[model samples]
Every structure is written in structure tokens, then in C-alpha cells.
Target: MDSGIGSQPLQEETADLKAPIAEPSINLDNRIPGLDDPYEHALKPNGDPWAILLKPEMETDKIQCDAWKEEVQTLLIFAGLFSAVVTAFVIESYKFLQPDPNDAIVRLLTQIANGSNATSSPASTSFTATAPSLRINIFWFISLILSLATVLVGTIALQWLREHQAYPACSPKQTLALLRMRSESLEAWHIPQVFAALPLLLQSALVLFLAGLIDFTLPLGPKISIPIACIIGLILVFLACTTILPSFQPLFLLSGRFSRDSVPSPCAFKSPQSQL
Candidate 1:
């Protein structure tokens, strides 16, 4: 009976302890301030301000399909240029392979000499190798001039394009200004290719002219061949010059939508934001 009474009192005390308690409220307004909000822009350091503007716009407006159009155009232009070069090579091969009168004369002379000089020396001895004169055609001289001119033009255009990339676009106004700048850019980008054509065309013309000029009747076969050889040598020189010069490659070739102003963001890749 005594044990039951003691356990009853302990149970009541445990129940009392388990009951919820209401504590008095205390006021605390103490906190430390952080350095600054990272989102609040005070000019985040970046190489391109145009990209900065583009990121925000891309997040808001989505459409990057226009870039595809620019890419296609660039590829097409490159393909056309490549095809032209291939065609030139084919034409050069055709001209070089064509049969000439000089070969026939050389053969005929060898046969006549073999029959005539039958005593001690063979008659074929009289058909010794003959060379043409070294007088170059006016056409070849003109072609050389054109080749040098084209090389000069290509060099100038490459330099101009390099200089155009130095300016920065920090604002929407500046971005729009680049649209105007593109006029200058186009000249820089296009002039090189145009100039390169001069040399290529000249070389092709000279190659054709020399191939067509092999006359067996003309005196000094060796001397005549010299001009053609020089023309061929000059063609090689011009081609070397072109290989060294920076050919035009427009930025739109990568992505036309990329301007001095904007580019598609990784997340907003589909957004087509205009530079202006």
C-alpha cells in the first residue's frame, strides 16, 4: 500500500514535468553587416561589355536561330572559294598536259639527223636538244603585276581587320555603333579575298598563255622556253605570297549572331539577341 502511494506521487511529478512551459520574451536586435551584395552590379569585371548586355537580354528574350543563317552563309562562301581554287588547278593541269608542236619537231629532227650522219657519227646526232629564246610575253608581265597587287591588297585587308577588333562595346549605344563599324569590317574582311583573286587569276592566265606558245618554227627553242619557265616560276612566287598572307575569314563564319554586342549564353543558347 505504501509503495503504491509513493509510485502515484512520482508519476504525478513526472506528468507535471512533461507539461509545456511559457517563458518570458527577450528583445535582441544585434547582427553584423556583410561586405556587399554580389548581385548589385558595380561593373563586374569582364573582357566584353557586349556579352554582359547579351546575357541579360538572352535571359529575357529567347531566339538564337538567326545565328544558323550566318553560319550557313559563311560556309557557302568558303565552299565557293574552295571550288574556284580546285577548278583553277584542274585548268592548269589540262593546259600542261596538252600536246605541243615542239615535241613533234624534236622527234622529226632526231629522225632526219640519224639518217644523214651515218659515216662516223650517227645522223641522229644532228637532232641535239634545242632551247627557245628568253623573250616574255606582255601578257605574262601584266599577270605578274596583278599578282603583286593582289598580295598587297590581301595584306592590307588582314591588317585592317585586326585593327577593327581593338575597340570595345560597353553599352547599347556602343553596340549599335558596331553596326556602323561593320561597314569598315566588311571592307577589311572582303578586300583580302578580292585582292587574292588578282594573283590567282593572273597565274592562271600566264599558265594558259605559256602552254599555248610552243612554236617549233621559231628559232632558239631553248630561248623561247625561258619566258614560259619564268612565267611558271612567277606563278609559284605569287602562290607562295598568297599562302603567307592572311585570307579573309569573317567572324560570322563561327556564329553570325556574335557581334561586338552580344553572343548566345550557355543556358540561353536558343535566344537570338541582336547586337544593336
Candidate 2:
């Protein structure tokens, strides 16, 4: 019986050792729910999600977008000059159409009221009536319309250039290659340089038109009116040469054989030639 009791104790010990110990119950509920994966909180301390997720390609895209913004701004400035010239043309046209006759009438009345012997001459009236020619008016109107059309074309071209600057499907490398090709062709032909200069030419034409209109309509004698018109013309020319021309100097220099080799690739994201 003692031997049987000792064997029963040994059997109980063996059975306990053979049984699987329940892994300390995991109790996922106590895990604070979403914190189960340690890597889920991998964001930097500043917590800027974009900064953390940004890639090389995204950085390149941002640089390209910035460069496009600058080019658009410069082109807009050039286009604005066209609008300014158009405004000046309209003002001069209005002045020519509705000249002030009150000054002459007032002078005549003042002489009559003062009982002066001076008589109003037919020559002065004839000159006033014949000053502005119908042909000149028609020419000025047509030129104004053309100037406006030029401005419209420039704006449209700028928009098109912006669209062509980048494409979503294009790999950055391919996009850069295309940008270089375009720059090379444009530089070789120097087309943009010529286009940029058109504003100055149009401004000169508009100024000359205004001077002629003023010369015809002004009540003052030719000695005074001619000099005034000349001064005004000079001022307009000065402004165009000093302000607009210098602003576009860089664009003008962006072409030619020297530029083809020396000019940096148009794409801001492209590696430098030396690096390449």
C-alpha cells in the first residue's frame, strides 16, 4: 500500500510536468489598442508628415514649379507693357476726337468784350477744322487693335509654356532631357529674345502715333506744339529703353552659341553639367 501511494505521487508529478503551461495570457485589451505595432509611430519629433514622406522626385518637382513661377512673372511684366501702350493709344485717340474749342472761343470773346480792334481770322478757324486727318485716325485705331492682339497672344503663349514645363507621367530624368532640348533649340534660334523685344517696338510706334495726334490737335502754334510733342516722344523712348529693355536683358542674353554651351539647363532639378 505504501508503495502504491508513493507511485501515485510520482504519477501526479509526471502528469503536472507533461501539461502545457498556458502562456501568460496576452490580454490584447491591455495593449492600448493601436500601440501594438511599435513602428506605427515612426514620424519625426516635429511630426511634419510631408517632411517625413518627401522623396527625391518630389523635391525635383517642387524646384521645377518654382522656376516656372519666375518665368511666368517675367513674361507677365513684358505683356503688361503692351496693355500700357494700348491705354496710352486710347487716351490720345480720345483727345484727338474731342479737342477743346473753348480756349479759342474764350479768347475771341475776351477781345470783343474789351473792345479791341483785333479781328478773328478765317485762317485760324480753317487750320483747326483741317488738323486731324481721317486717314491717321483710322491708322491709329488699327494699330491699337493690333497691339491688343499681341498682348493676348503673349499671355496665351505664357500659359502654354507653363503647361509644357512639366508633366505628371514623365520621369524626372526624361523631363529634364526634354527641357534641355527645348532650351537648346530656343537658344539656337533666339526666338524668345525677339519676342521679348516686340513690346519696345510697339511702344515706339504708339509714342509716334501719339506725337502726331498731339501735333494736329494742340491749339498752340507749331513752334510750341512740335517741341512739346518731341519732348513727350523722347520721354517715352527713354522709359522704354531704360526700364523695359534692361529688365529683359537677361532674356536676350539667354541665346546664341555661347549661351548654348554656357547657359545652365532650364530645368532647376537637373544635375549640373560638371556633375553630369
| Number of the predicted model whose lDDT against the real structure is largest | 2
For model 2, residues 167-255, the per-residue Cα lDDT tens digits are 55654445555655765665687545545554544554566566556745466688778787777878876654555544444566665
Clashes of 2: 0
In Å, residue 211's CA in model 1 sits off its true spot by 4.5
Ten contiguous residues minimizing lDDT sum, candidate 2: 267-276
**RMSD to true structure for each model, in Å:** 20.6, 17.7
lDDT at residue 12 of model 1 (Cα atoms): 93
Q: Which ten residues in a row have the lowest lDDT in candidate 1?
A: 267-276
For candidate 2, what's the RMSD? 17.7
lDDT of each: 0.46, 0.57
**Model 2 residue pairs with clashes:** none
TM-scores for every candidate against the unseen true structure: 0.28, 0.40
Instruction: Give the per-residue lDDT of model 1 (tens digit) for 17-86.
Output: 9999998866463555443323334665655555665555433322322332343344345434544543
Candidate 2 accuracy as TM-score: 0.40
